[model samples]
Target: MKIAINGFGRIGRTILRQILTTARGSGIQVLCINDIAEPEMCAYLFQYDSTFGPFPGQVALETGALVVDGRRIPLHQQANVTALDLSGADVLLDCTGIARSTDLAERGLSAGATKVLISGPSPAAEATVVYGVNTKDIKGARIVSNASCTTNAVAALVQLVDQVAGIDSGHMTTIHCYTNSQPMVDAPRGDFARSRGGAQSMVPTTTSAMHLIDVVLPHLRGRISGAAVRVPTASVSAVDLVARLNTPLAEADLMVALRAAADRSPVLGWTDQPLVSSDLRARPESLVIAAPETRIVDSRQLRIFGWYDNEWGFSARMLDVAAKMAEAD
Candidate 1:
């Protein structure tokens, strides 16, 4: 499987590193990378990630090609998706986040790519997949979107709870870490609150996790609401989820269900040990349930807290989705 990366930001680089290290035997190859950044800058960023530490393998640029651990991949400085040569790519991972329309997404297909996977939520996606929750529904879809980190975190727990006790209604509050979208210093922008310095304050913002969740779990449409606040942090975020259940469940029973789900699903993780947000860095699972923070009230309402390394975990799931799509082909 020849993969082409459309963006070289945090998620794009993470996915490249992940493929170089783990997907070697799966026949997955990163044939080319497309980004607006200069080749040297992208190579530099790939070699040194502040959040994930230095790259496990060396990276070098040779004749306008990127050599990662001895594999030379072409680097293209192109921003227009339709203008690129994608004849050899089996999958094009659009980590750009800017391609939100069906017309934009079709550019990859029109350019001769077999499939295109968007790294984040998009209205143009044929199907929005959450690895553990709804990947079974992605049967050879040409365009797929791996919702968002928050959606992945919330959907895993919600699906587990719904399977065990049945959810009546729910709400999720994601205490998220700052992203590249936020400004480092106060600046003029359309959204006044987000334009403020990101590292200096906690800013409440809207999240599309709820709507994307409905895309994956259509049965839960209009049953969930969500909000997010970006805090001053480089990595790790928490999701505070509350759900009302139709079937009453004991706390112990809920724990048992979560443990079973964790064992069965690759995307769900359960931890009883006391852990802070920093403890979850580099974790590949979509969400790690903080068992210590699990609580139930009157055997009907449930509260669960989950921690996720948004960039790493979400990118990992994107690779998983890409691999699954490859298999389907």
Candidate 2:
């Protein structure tokens, strides 16, 4: 499948690397890139990544293209999506995170792409698929959303737990990594707390994952609520969840079921060791169940912890969604 990337930020660059490396068989071929960044700058950023280390493949820049592994991908620094020509693209990934509405995202289709995929939450999307949780909802929908990174982890974890042992209600807190949205040093921003230094201190903030959990797993609507804490970390985040289960389960039995679930899932993982955030760097699974931290109180109350490389895992799932979109056609 030939794919075009709209934004050449963290997610966009990672997606390209994943296709050539980890997600090699996903059938994704880079058709073109439409970003506001200069071709040379894009090549440089793609070459040296802070979280994933330097890209393994050769990265170079030509007249108007970025070359990776000897493949010359046309790079266009177009601020207007409608102005760029996106012909022959099986899917155009709108990773800009700015196209939140169907009207805004469908401009890819208007520009001649077959399908449009928003990398973040788009309640206006024809279908919002949290790949591992509800990719069944992705039935030939032209405009689809893979939701957000936190949403993917939360939905995958919640769905697994809910399927194994029934969950009545839960409150989740994601110990998330700070993004570019946050400031490097104390600076002016709308949200006072978020305006504080991102890598300096932990910041408590709201997450769209809370509301999006309801969108993907509609049955779990009103059952789960969550927030985020931006910790001082470069990569990898964890989900801290406390829930009351309909079927009261012991930790041992729950582990057995969850282990079995992870065994059968491609996008879910289980780890028994006492692993930290960096341990999960470059992990492809949306969430890895941390066995050592599982706790149960009153038998009915359940607590679970899941680790995820938010950037890598979310980009991996986008490939999954793109593949599904191509198959459906």
Candidate 3:
């Protein structure tokens, strides 16, 4: 599979790293990378990532291209998707985050990509897959989304509970880590709340993940609501999800159901050990249920704590989706 990545940000770079390291024998090759950053600078950033540490192999700039483990991958310092030469690419992963419109996303197809996968939620997406939740729906989808990290973290639990007891309604509060979109220092921006420095405070922000959940699980439409707060952290995000189920279960049975779901789904992980946010870094699964922290209120209400490596986990899922798309072709 020939792949092209549009953005070299958090998720994009991680996807490239995964394809180069863990996905080596999967027949996936990164044909080209298109980003606004200069080729040399992109090499530097890819070589040294603070959150995930250094690249496994040496990354050097050779003849205006990035050479990773003797493999040369050209980097194009272009923002216009239509100008990219992606004819050899079978899949284009648009981690740019700005390609939220169909017109913008279709540029990849126009540029010669067979399939386009957006890293984040996009309204134009034919399907928004949440890995274990609804990946089967992406069998023949050309332009799909992997959904947001938060949605991936919650979708499995939602589906598992809905199947076991049926979810009547739910609300999620995601304690998320700061992202590149936020300002590092207090600076003026359109939104007052977001204008505050990301590293300086816990800022409440609106999340589009709930809308994405509705797309993946239409039965939860109009029944689920959610909010997010970006805390001062470098990595790892947690979700506090509370749901009202149609059926009630004892604590022991509830645990059994959750464990069974995790066992059936490779994207979901269940752990009873007390874990901190740092312990979840580089975890490949979409969601890790903190079993010890899960609580049940009045039997009908359930509160679950889930953790995820937002960048790594989500990027891993993106690659999984890409592989599925490639196989379908």
**Local distance difference test, each candidate:** 0.88, 0.89, 0.88
Best by lDDT: 2
Model 3's TM-score against the true structure: 0.96
User: Which candidate ranks first by TM-score, i.e. highest?
Assistant: 2
Q: Mind giving the per-residue lDDT tens digits that candidate 2 earns over 1-329?
A: 98999999999999988987874535567888988987778889999998899989788899889887898888998887888878888899999988987678889999999898899988668999998788888886999999999999989989888998889999999999999999989998999999999989999999999988998899989999888999999899999999899997877888898899888887899999999999999998899999999999988898999999999999999989888887785
Candidate 1: Cα lDDT at 93: 94
Among all windows of ten consecutive residues in candidate 1, which has the lowest summed lDDT?
20-29
Model 1 scores what on Cα lDDT?
Answer: 0.88
lDDT, candidate 2, at 245: 92
Clashes of each: 0, 0, 0
Worst 10 residues of 2 by lDDT: 20-29
Clashing pairs in 2: none
**CA shift of 15, model 1, Å:** 0.2
- Shift of residue 176 alpha carbon in model 2, Å: 0.2
lDDT of 3: 0.88
Order the numbered candidates by lDDT, best leading: 2, 1, 3
> Of 1 and 2, which scores higher on TM-score?
2
